[model samples]
Target chain A: MAVHQRQTVPQAADRLMPSGAAHHEQVVARQRRGRIWAIVFQAAMLAGIVALCALLLNILNQSFGYVAIVNTIDPAELAVDGVPLNELPKENLVEILEANISAGLMRRYEHDIPFAERSRENVHDLILERVVEPQVQATWGLFDSIFARDSVFAEADERFPGSDVYFRSWLTTSFISKSQSSEPLRAGVRTAIFGSLWVVAITILFSFPIGVGAAIYLEEYAHKERLLNRLIQTNINNLAGVPSIIYGMLGLAIFVRILELFTSGAFLGIGDQSTANGRTIISAGLTLGLLILPLIIINGQEAIRAVPNSLRQAGFGLGATHWQVIWHHVLPSAMPGVLTGTILAVSRAIGETAPLVVVGASTFIALDPSGPFSKFTVLPIQIYQWTSRPQDEFRNLAAAAILVLLILLLSLNASAVLLRNRFDRSRAIA
Target chain B: MSRSAPIAQAAISAESMQGPVAGAESTSESVLGGGPPLDLSRKPRVAESLIQGFLFLCGAISILTTLGIVYVLGRESLLFFANEEVNLLKFFGGTEWQPAIGRFGIWPLVTATFMASLIAMAVALPMGLCIAIYLSEYAPQRTRSVLKPILEVLAGIPTVVYGYFALTFMTPLLRGIFGRDIVEIYNTASAGIVIGILVIPLVSSMSEDALSAVPNALRQASYGLGATRLETAVRIVLPAALSGVAAAFIVAISRAIGETMIVAIAAGAGPNFTFSPFRAAETMTGHIVRISGGDLSYDSIDYNSIFAIGLLLFLLTLSLNVLSQWIVRRFREEYE
Candidate 1:
């Protein structure tokens, strides 16, 4: 019995030792594999952050750089009575514009905004664009401008002997205030900004009320069991996924063609009959309104649905009608969420170029939109047009425009976030 | 509560007393004298009906918009097909695309669109999956919150800006990597890369939702079987969330197909039927924009062609979106 026990104990020991060791090794190997995968995942996240940084860096590099400006007619030469062109009187600047450009162009400009009523600053800009006609002979990106300043200057001097080399930010205050020009130095985004504002304003006017109303009906009034209601709900969900360019096509077919009279202001007798057609701000707005309508409706429904059922029940107990309960309690509580959605939708609308392009936003228009009926150019189209140009300076201008657009979009989103946060905090306290 | 109850009762009594006087003053004197007291509540009911009607009208507009889109696309596409100058057989089967000289072949645009979309998917799918896996399985709450919004910011940046980035930055980088001769100035590769970057947020967000929706018990079971985190994530979690991942991929592909500004600005204007990503090519959306942006006269064949292209694009994206929705609905895992 003692000999049998001894042999069994040794055999048990031998079995346990190898198996335990193998288990330990397997766990270690798995841990190593896990660590590797964790690194890979982290690397992917890092790539996203890096890509974002690169995009911003690239835009910044293009927006501000060393530019060699060589005017066709020197500002000093154009100075009248010892007054430099930069400091020239409004009258002198106007005279220069009238003298240089064609009579037809001058007449059109005057007719569009009236030269007599023009601001002094406006006349100054006109002189810079039409008279001086400053051309960028060479440009260096932000990196080269700073690190290789001497080399850039040398190259500029070698290429454009008389040109003045300066580090310029294309996004000056004047950039937003001045009008577009063939000359990159004179090009600005004033008309485009105004057009964008007009389109966005109209988009909001059309979309917000309709979107919210649809949400109210779908969430509070429509019975889920009803086939019609289910169909409407399904349609809304699908509409949200429809490509934006399709909306542009719809705008082209309907607003630009079928509804031309109303959109072109011919019916209202308000627009320039000759140049103005259905491709106007109103059409673009309505198209974008359609583009974002589904987004707003879906978001609005979500916000309304998020309102607790207890609140509705309590209102009913107080003898409040269904409509009254929704109007008074549901809407108020859902407002922050609704506004958040609207802000997102508006941001999307502002950044949208596809639908607007399809809706026939002008690629270049110096004149600001007079009203909804006027032909318009938005910021995206302006940037697109500039980027398509061959000159390096136009790319710089496009970069600057991108910065403006980003800032505008980010601020709008940030404000919405802040507002939502405040609302959430207030609600939590209550 | 007791103290406020008496005040509420008094206010109600006062309101009831004043209600009759207000009603009598507001209503016609003859009706007030002879007929039963006016049903004041009926006024609110009438307003309620009016409001309901308006809201219902608003709801109907969305459905109308869908109908409008279908009608417009169909009507114009029919016009395009009816024109004798545009041959339907050549449009479907031919490789060449020269609209100016009267060749209306569409294969070039379709091929370019497919090439760019394929390139975009190649970059976006794996990276997006990695991001989703990390966010769902690895990231702490704080990191997720910080990272998610930043990714959304990437989504929010204007597509025109991405176009510019592709033109100036991505193209130059590609030229540096593959000798200048290989990569054209307006190659599809750069645009495809930028587009991939643009869609990363979309793919990652959708996939993360899918991964997060996976039941924790499956993960726990895998762990109980002595599986590592990587093994569990790849073998168990990913398989369980396969439909969701596929849906995200399909949706991203649709978005890439419909994307306009990037391709319009960065991809070359000419429609080349080449399968090479490094060459200049135009997509269907790009072709539509380029033609429509020009001064094409009404009733001209060129004008009609854009609508035809638009119709094709619409069908492609619509089918993809519907498929994605169907997949999500059909295969979604519901864990109690």
Candidate 2:
């Protein structure tokens, strides 16, 4: 009788649970849809990451791969066929190799081939040497000629022309040791590197103190909601986004022409004295400094803003002056962020070739810049000069320079990150 | 006992305090508890007034920069018009740009600049929007983490590199694909395409932020109403984020307009006023670069031309930037 009663009660319970059962089903269905959406979102992000990796990999392969191959050309053979460095014998081999390799690599390296010099004695003498020597040969014996059309092996020269000595490594001790050349094969980035460094150094010196000072004055001392405050805020934002080349034009008009303290005179000045007045490193740096000043101010302001109001209150409570509170407490707390911003600005300045180019960062200068007043070039400008040449050797030089630039940019960014992490950890401990 | 103890304590305290009271009287009693409390309370207004002055000075710097724009551009453009025989209408409508031949018409260069930038935006918009969609909706957390930084890196690569890539790699690639040399080594197509690529990050990052701002609850509601993930995204979240995304797109367009190196390097040095993407073209900034390349004096018409171009370019970008700010303000919702 009791068992029968229990069965009857369960039946009643089932009837009562009909609405609750439907609601439970509805909740489960919604959750299933949410999970599916989450999966889809995750998948899309993964695809983006994969695509990004592929692009970077492709750039590295093309750029660094060329570096690896160019490092093989025998510098001595290249030097023997001198005057213009494009006459280097092994450079031609690299071009042929570049053309036949992977379609992408072939396309990239096709313009770097070196040319041969005309024989000096007589018109017939040149023809005779060409006839006797057969001009181009494979480095790994005649057997390698079968694959000579391949882009990877095209750069190999069997022996130095006119001499039986086997030639190797076109990127010689002198490749890095030399100055800029119209011949892409012979061009080195030493001057460009120094120019870049000096330009960036001067830019930092000019922009940092001024930008930080302005930020401090605005954030710490300046009262809020005033007309002047509003104006400054608006200008900082607008200046940050102004086209850099506009600044270049301004630099040309203002520094090069208006003041004219330093006139361009050939031999003593840049390539054309009368035309390129005020085209010195100082002008370029100052222009860039102005270009990035707003960025610094905005970043500095944010760092200052991040300092807690409680700390300021505590400083006031301790009988510290307003300036004392900021100097002792707020600035120390904000230093890490300020440093990070400066690093990012420096990175931007280093990578920027546009405004600098607009302001006339010389395309082809054969010597390193010695001082701030010197006319100079940077890596990008050098790359532009090299890759523009009709010859193939310069293409390789451009690739190498690009690799160096990428490495430099990457390392700088990495250091900034490392510094931020270190600072954050220390702050946590404090 | 308690009353006697209290009386004894009071007598002892009164005896001790009497000497100090006499000493204070001898030193001349303080007045109004070291002056009125209301006087001390008024100090904040003085401090605030000083702060107001400091803010004014800070604001002046920005005002100066803005004023400098008008002064520099206005003065130079006026001088240009004064020196020129033709007026503003003819200059704007004129077909020729041969400065050496003494023609000062800037129409052709302007059109070409617009055409290239338009093409860049056309390419960048779809690709960037798609990438942002993928990042916001499709990618896994781990994937998003890795890819976001890489995209930023792509954006960060120097423009010079892009120029070289366009000149060497892109030109050849396009030529091969077209089965004919559709693009010259210095044609607008390569530079425009590279600019499109450069702008991808700007659009994608901003759009991602916009899309992320849409409430998850809305997506849930849409899904609960029997919509697919795509449907929900398109019909609900996308509409909600539309204004912000539009603002982002404009900013990207502005960036493309201002791009100099890629155009200067990949785009030919020619000032041809043609609309063909296959031809070498010049932009306003490009013209500035070209004009500034010569041996012109500060006050020369050639030098002044740069400022004229610069001023126009600045105004266009400044207005676009202002529009972007307006959009952000109009559409932004306060979410706690």
Candidate 3:
């Protein structure tokens, strides 16, 4: 009745026509404005994509291309009476190494690895290193190598005449398998990869169980109003935000300085105790473990929070203990989520350089991290070292390492996302 | 008999003195504590008690970590100041940070840190807000899903890789734009810009959460009033999540300030007190990494000074975190 009366009123008709026309115009204007802002917002979103793309593209650009490989002594010259240097037996190769280099150096090599014990291929490698030193004199990126091929060759000729302008993928099979070398062409991330694995393994071992335990306490056991519980909760939150370098300093003081014997394995009468000053894989891993502990606990709590109360109720209804309910029902349901969180944490720990730097990760560690007590250089630290050098070739090596690091991080993260999605799907089904 | 309840309270049944179990873990869909409490006299499981104690101990490690950081930074910083070559006032007041010359003025490093972070925030804040708004309001579900992992990838890229990007790509690009001579080979601009890029994911993700939490009613009401989505986003949803957005901004700034590798690599060598982003400067993190990367004796002033800087960095980040928390608690808009 009120609607009919208002519609019948003459004053309403006067108000409606003018306002309707004006409102239509205003709506058009507003919609236009909205469209513009939406584009602006979208552009901002694309900026991240653009930045990420540029970063990756830049890395890829430098990771491969033509290199001017200049040999210190031409391989043809090393051929002795129709026998190539590489074709020579281990003894002949050792002879070549001995004849070309200093006797002192030859003796050092002998002391390091006796020629009789060394494989033929290894001796050939030694011959190449000591004699036929193929060095990268100048390089062109993948972009220039492909699009501007003529220019690259011309520039190589002008800048490094007589050097072989070979198309070389910096990330070759040998790069993955070989150890670190001063020569950019020979330097590989094998040792760094081993170090990264050891550090990450130690990180997971230290963090996962303790993180889950902390989450279980906070979620399933602790009193909400209790002071200690609140403190712990707040402390975890704060710790999550604490600058990672602070953790580095803590590790330096406590693990490196204060507890040197333990980390160095001196207390256990293992490792090289005399040379070990506690800057080892153990310290780096512990630092990172502390760095990511809060992350794990927080995400673990998130996972636990996702579990349905009915499941717990069902368990308790069957006269099961609280721990049994948690173990059988809550924990199983939360496992995927917890694992996802852990993988993400592990990825972060893997990429982290600053904390490990403070804990004294050797950038030039040649040997693989044999044990927790051994000196280590993770992939990121290796990249940092290479990139910091004021040489374009080292930058190329750094880009290759970046590619490797990104692949590792991406695989780990993709698994995390997959786990989360699977969990979500299961929840949706249940 | 309620010990271990509050550290010292030893209760066989830990929940005996407490009221009906109201688990905070329960989701909104299921209100827990509907079941009656367990019998108080029931036999306690030993594994349950032991596990609870173990979990409690695990929880305490975070506290221990915090204490460890504080103690180390504090003790070392004190040692730094105790040195005859260094004093508290000169450390802060001195403009030249060359420790070899006994001039410990931290102003250059602090100012450099501030300027770099300032540039970072300048780039990140507006861009991050836009990203948050875009994701929250305008993006299709598929777009959001695809972008989620992509953003994670962006965020997960190591700082060292970013340093490489800054030094190799960003620096050359900047030099091309601003002329090679004006922009130093290692300049703050590239590092700051890259750091800002690093932080965008953080700010956007946090702000997106805040925006997602705002009730749909506000957006619907604005639309009913003939407001466009853009107006609704700016005038209604943003205001509603303003506290959260503010928190995100502060957190982003703190992160940028604490960033090490990019600044260390691209921000150049030496502690240069300069206002120009195109010039080289060293941040506290950069200085720390450079100084400590070399072998310095344990008790030397140089070694101790990095600790002092670490203390400053630690305090600055901690306070920002606490402040962000306070802001969220104090001003969060409660929706029914």
Candidate 4:
């Protein structure tokens, strides 16, 4: 033992004491490398931030821009006795619109708002919409419009001499109120927004109670050793990781095909007969609900698990039944956390697109979704569709729609995160 | 320390509180409520049992979802393969995917998905790791708070918006850089790059969590030996959290594989079996979206083909998810 200890001491000493200059040089070299790499890591973080900034900037750049509008038939030509189109009498304007557009289109317009009841300005606006048809000839980015204003004007002059240039903010209030149009100049997100609201509302309604109940069962009732409980736990973990597109297929098969009668509301005798099949708001909602259900369950389980056992014991100490104890103590303490999870899940559902695409959200839906049984198109789907179109002006509309979607999802995410922090604080105080 | 002792233990504890006037027998009777002699053989009311059963049923819904997906995919895939136009061997071996020409080989779609995923990983892994390391080891609290929420917001942006970004911004940018002839407007590179951007938050957030979980003592020991922070982070902390980082990588890869809108909107429409990221190609998810998004006739080869593709996608993602779960379970280093 003494010989071994002596030999180990020399070896240890030799390992620790290297040649001084070489060791010092190597140390310096490593420190320099570390400094360089640390900068590189920081740059990587900056790159992420930069990418995010660029994405927002690019969307912003497109949402507000200049468009050159060229009228097919100048309203000046429609003027009577030098009176402008907007100044024309209501009956004259109505007559002008009826003469220019197809009989079916005129009848449809009259059906929308009876010609007699329409205001003089309203009729005049219709004349311009159905006849004058101010088509966007060219679109320029916001940066170009602002920074290279002369170039924009020069290009417009070279390409579209008769066109009028207007600085347009595509995300205006009218944009929110107006329905979508085939013309990029008149397109809006009103229909898509309504569709999104209905689908998300249904998703929340279906997932919240079931998700919370499942969490209560997993956390409060099931023993860890039970085979069924284990199976359920593992199943949920896997389901949460499943790609959302797969859920779309499941929805297509189950809700749209097999349960078409039920989901279409035909069984309820109030089905939107025009659709005559599933492909309704309810089906989309249910699919998204299933997609986010596992998320809510997992989150709720964590929240319930965080509840102090002493609280449950306190309820039981008063001779409360098991259910009573849970109802009075565990649930109240966990409710905020549960809500946080639900909000996050809802936010995720709001932004989800891949699944909805597969579930058959209409890409060009013009009519607003009126009920759960109505065919629908959501905001994301609208953006997807518009971005795919060949026209550059529709790309502007896509950016504007993207802006609206980002606002909604960001607010939802912020509220949920704030709620989580507040809940955490409250627990710390307790 | 007993959180909730059994009812018998509670009864026994309650006995000690009884006055001297009551003997043990009387005490028991008093606690049992002598009027009914507290029934030891408790019977759950129908409503109570029903509620518990209902909660259990809610938890079991996940199982139903899995079964439904499997049954639907399996049945539809069986029908799809049964179609004379779609041969089982050709589905595996051929490289084309034109339904009109009766060519249903899956290799074109598979190769496209592989190229897109490869490019996505190329962008995501290095950037995600660097961000994770900087955030976990070096960032101040203020920076962490600000940057983390921004990452969350980045993640919260819809994939559709990313598709728009890919289509409108990233593709144009790539075209200008590479010249128009070399890079198609709807090429796979932009879709892959944008997908990479979309998942950067996911990868960084998860990897940061793993890196943060490594014990501080390990770092202090490395510092005691005169190692730099970067060295300690790279050589000491990273290796310890290797399994967790690997799981995050797997998850990121799976996400990139399954991403649909970006690829659908930007990664071209026609399926092409190509290795070049610069060329136009259609991915599996992209193909499914395109076929289903339009007015596809019911039970046609095109309709049935989407199911086969869906089934394949499901199996691929499922296996990756399981593999990630297994890695975490088997190789995770439990820290004190």
Candidate 5:
């Protein structure tokens, strides 16, 4: 042992002497590489965040610029009143454009002469300067106002009358307005907005009760040994990961044709069998509901699972019935989670265009859907339709519509967070 | 120490023996409260059975949802095959997807879907793992508390916003850098990259949980062995949490596959069977949207193709999800 210790001490002495200089250099080189890599990794992370922010800033800057610059064109200066609306004077152009948009020319540009043949600047230019620009300006202000509106936009509008304004409030009014011609400058997403509302309402109605009930049963009632229950728990988790487009396919098969329940049959015994709205709003809603069900169930289960077991035990010990224990004890404790889950699920449902599009939710209805079986169009589909057009105006409208949808989504999430905070505090107190 | 220690040990042993018996006695006492409190020999048969039944029913609902999924997918897929004569091998193996030519081969859509998912994983894995490392090892408690919630908010942003960002910003930026024709207005790269961004939160959050699950003692031992904090984390803690990290990756991949809006809005709808990520290509979901958009008859081959694609997608995602769950369950760390 003493000899081995003497050898180890010699090895240490070698490091202290010049003999181990190469080893020390090698160790230093390795440490330098490691430090360099760590620095690189940190820089890369910072770069990612910066890149994301830059992308967001770029979109905001470009779209706002488009709104500002494009709106500056005075349609009154390009007067050709003997001809189409785009040829009229800027002051007359605004009046004509508003009248045309109100007359549904904005939504159905194909019927207008400008759509048939691209006139000078197309009909979209006049529509842009008059209808869409003003509309986006108004809605943009409304959105800013929702989050404590500063005077910057109001000041900009006041400073630049009939010129480019700061927060174009036109998006709000444009969003509420109906669809327009391929001219994005004039197009709006009103039809899509109404369609999204209907679809979301139906999705929530279908998924909420079922999801919460399933969670309640799983957390508060299910026996540990039940194989069937175990199988379900497993499948729900799996289902949560299933691709959403698969749901669209399911909707197509189950809701559109085979079911033949809502509008698959001959509509009013007049339209050809091939020309019916087989894909109705009901099918779209059901498909979306199923798509988001697993999300709701998983979230609901987590929340329910988070509830202390002692609460249930306490309820049972207090002579509460089994249903009472679940209803009064377990359900209330998990309400915040359920609420957040519901909000998230609804947000997903509202934004889903693929599944609904597959289910034939793309029918361009002029008016709002009056019933579950009515033909519907949602915001994404509307944006898609507008953006797909060759005209540049449609692109602007798509941006404005996107802003509106973003606002709705943000508000919904904000409310959910608020609700969660309130419930969290209450639960802590209890 | 001598008196209290033995007494505490004796109390614990005695309580273990008596705990269950006492629990049962209390339960009986609640039900048979009108009788003697000491003579708790009765069982609350009705109460116990009722509770058991309620739980069984809950289990049954879950069973029902699963059955419903299988039933729905099975019935439609069966109907699809009953009406069409698609050679399964050719559908997957064929290099083209031209419906006008009567070729129902789906290789293009499958390729798009897989390529996009691969790109997403490629971007998300390293980035997510690194962020997990920062969160679990480096970040202070207050910083972690702040950053985690912000990351979650990023996840909660509606996919439509991501889609818009891809179309309006990412595509334009890429085009400017690479030249106009280098990237189409609607290309797979933008969607794939943005989808990666969408799934980052999922990957990082799950991986952090996994890393946290690794015992601190293991980390301390590695440090005691003269390893740096970074080395200990990368070598010891990460290895211990390898299974969990893998599961998180799989789940993130699954999420990328299922995502629709970003792809639908940003990815081009042209269904060309090409492997070029920069090209405008169609996905299985994208094709479903395109075909459904067109005015096709209910019984047309094009209509039936939707279900076929859906069935294939379902099978692919279902397996990934199941595998993820299996990995999570098999390697989950348990604490005393």
Candidate 6:
């Protein structure tokens, strides 16, 4: 054994030592390749960061810039009692709307939503949308607007005679307060915001309790060896990966068609009978709820499973029932985690567009969503419609809307991260 | 250890064992004064049964939802087939997709969908692998925490916004590179590129999880053998995580296939069976949106056609998901 070890030691030493300059060069070449690859990996990561920054910068660039707007009916022609149109009173704006729009359109507007009950600001918005119909003739990017302001104004004047050039930030307080319009200058995301809020609320209400319950049943109650339990578990994992648009088709067929009476608010007896249909907030909400259900259930299951089994055993050893132990001991510990999951699910619901589009989200709706039964659109759909328009101004509006969506999503995710950290701290302490 | 002291002490006490029942009895006696204590045990039985039933029902809802999806899609697809004009052979084999003129050929849409997915994969796969390798092997913990969240922010950005970015920025950039005549205003290349960007975070996050799951011993052994970090990552870690990386690829492809807004807004609303990425084309999701967005009569052929397309899409994505889940399960079993 000593002789064998001596021979092996010499052979190992020989293998470790480089035999010549050629071997040393080969090792150096390999090391250089490794360094190149490391640099490539770092560059790939930087590319991801660059892509994100470019997206945000591009959207922001379009959201605020110099725009050349030409009004269809010159504001000078609509002066009341020698007051310029821009400086006129609210009542005069209402008068201008009534005078300019067709009688049929005026009647339809009143029928859809009473003109008299509408606030002065609403009337002003209507006048701006229908009467003036300001069309964007030219747009310059933010860089051009800032660095070449004089050149931009000069170009606008040369291209669009008698047009007004203004640096407009499409995202404003009014942009969040007013409803949609055919004219980009007057359009706002108020209705879409409300629609998104209502839909997300319903999604939470429907998915949360059920998701938590499902998680509890799966994690604490169901026997792991049972086939039914295994099937249910597998089904859920598969569902989490299903493309969201399929859920929309399900909504269209079931919520919008088979159960139209309920979704259209006919059963509730509250929606507008003339215009109300199954393409309402309820269908969209339910569809989104379905889309996020698997996500919530899966996340909740993970949270519940993470709770220490010893806690449950302690409750059971104290003569507590299974349900009692779960309620008092397991749920409290899992609450923060469950809430984080819910927040994430809701964020996903808020950003989802494909399913809502399939569920027949309206492209243009001025009326606010009064209830679950009302026809509605959401922020993503609004952004989509605006982006598709031929006008450059609508693209600006799309960018502004995108900013609002990004803020909403980031805030929700940030809260989720905070909640998760809190959970982690509590767990560490325990 | 100190925080668990009280709980551990409570577990050893006899009073704690009878804690719930005794407390309930005392509270009941005080409230009723002269009356007998309430049957706390019996009371919880009824409530326990009800809660258990409720939880079971909630679990059933997921199953019910799956059933509902299947039933609804099946019903509508059957109705679509019941129409005399929809020939099964022609629907699958035909190359043209002019549904407006009563041509129900689906291959054109399928080709467009696959073409876009392929382009998206070409951009996403390598970038995602490199990012994953960097995050798992090279990046420090602090950098990982910061960069991972930032990458997720890219994932969370709504697809519609990506659509706008593609149409406004990427398309113009591509136009400048490829010239106006070659790059159509609404070409698949721009949409596919943005979709790839959207998918990068998904792929990177998933592949990083896979790469990090590789045992540290493997990496250390390679290092001990005089292997460089990059060589160890590329030669040893990647091979071990191959199944997981493949699963990520499949899932990302499924996502790309189902992506709607980017294609709908940027890839023009025309189904064309072409090999060129520079041409404007319509994908399956795009076609569904276009038809559904328009005003069609309730029972019209166009309405039924969308259901058929949805069924096809559903099946495709479902199979992909199932395959990915299978691969993941197999990988987990092999590793753990």
Highest DockQ, which number?
Answer: 4
lDDT of 2 at A86: 38
The parts of candidate 5 lying over 4 Å away from their true place are A1-31, A66-170, A177-183, A262-278, B1-85, B333-336
Cα-based lDDT at residue B133, candidate 5: 79
Candidate 5, residues B188-252: lDDT per residue as tens digits?
A: 88889888888888898999999998989998898776566677778899989888999999989
What are the per-residue Cα lDDT tens digits for candidate 4 across A1-430? 0222323345457665553456567767887898999999999999999999999999999999889999999888998778888877777888788888899988887789888998987787677777898999889889998999999999999999999898988899978988989988778899999999999999999999999999999988887778999999999998988889999999999999999999999998896787678899999999999999999999999999888776766555556656776788889999989999899899889889989988888877788887999999998888888888899999999999999998998788778879888988988897
For candidate 5, the clash count comes to 27
- Candidate achieving the largest TM-score: 4
- lDDT per model vs. reference: 0.86, 0.67, 0.87, 0.87, 0.69, 0.85
Worst 10 residues of 6 chain A by lDDT: A1-10
* Candidate 6 residue pairs that clash: none
Which 10 consecutive residues of model 5 chain B have the lowest summed lDDT? B11-20
lDDT of 3 at A96: 80
Can you give the TM-score per candidate against the true fold? 0.89, 0.74, 0.91, 0.93, 0.77, 0.89
TM-score of chain B of each: 0.86, 0.82, 0.87, 0.91, 0.83, 0.87
lDDT of 2 by residue, A5-109 (tens): 333355567665433556556555755776675665555445545544544543443432221122233334333335332343454434433333465644433
- Give residue A391's lDDT in candidate 6 (0 to 100): 79
Q: Compared with the true structure, what per-residue lDDT tens digits does model 3 show for residues A1-430? A: 0222333446657665334456556666877888999999999999989999999999999999988988899988878788987677777777788889998888888899887898999988887887888888888889898999999989989988899998888888899898998988789999999999999999999999999999998999888899989999999998988877778889988999999989998888887666778999998898899999999999999999988776776565444567887889989999998999999899999999988888888867677777999988999999999998988899999999888999998888888878888888988998
Task: Per model, state how many residue pairs clash.
Answer: 0, 38, 8, 0, 27, 0
Clashing pairs in 3: B2-B9, B2-B10, B3-B9, B3-B10, B3-B11, B4-B9, B4-B10, B94-B105
The residue-by-residue lDDT of candidate 1 on B250-283, one tens digit each, is 9999999988888888889989989889999999
Question: Residue A412 in model 2: shift from native, Å?
Answer: 1.2
Better of 1 and 4 by DockQ: 4
Q: Over 4 Å off in model 3, which ranges?
A: A1-28, A80-98, A111-117, B1-45
Supply the TM-score for candidate 1.
0.89
Q: Candidate 4 DockQ category?
A: acceptable
Q: Candidate 4, residues B1-336: lDDT per residue as tens digits?
A: 223333334532322321111121222444542364454225445666788899999999999999999999998899999987788899999999998899989999999998999889999999999999999999998999889988888888889888888888899999999999999888999999999999999999999999999999999998887678888999999999999999999999999989998999999999999888999999999999998988977788788889999999999988998999999999999988
Choose 2 or 6, whichever is better by DockQ. Answer: 6
Candidate 3 at B57: error in angstroms?
0.8
TM-score of the A chain in model 4: 0.92
Candidate ranking under DockQ, highest first, comes to 4, 6, 3, 1, 5, 2
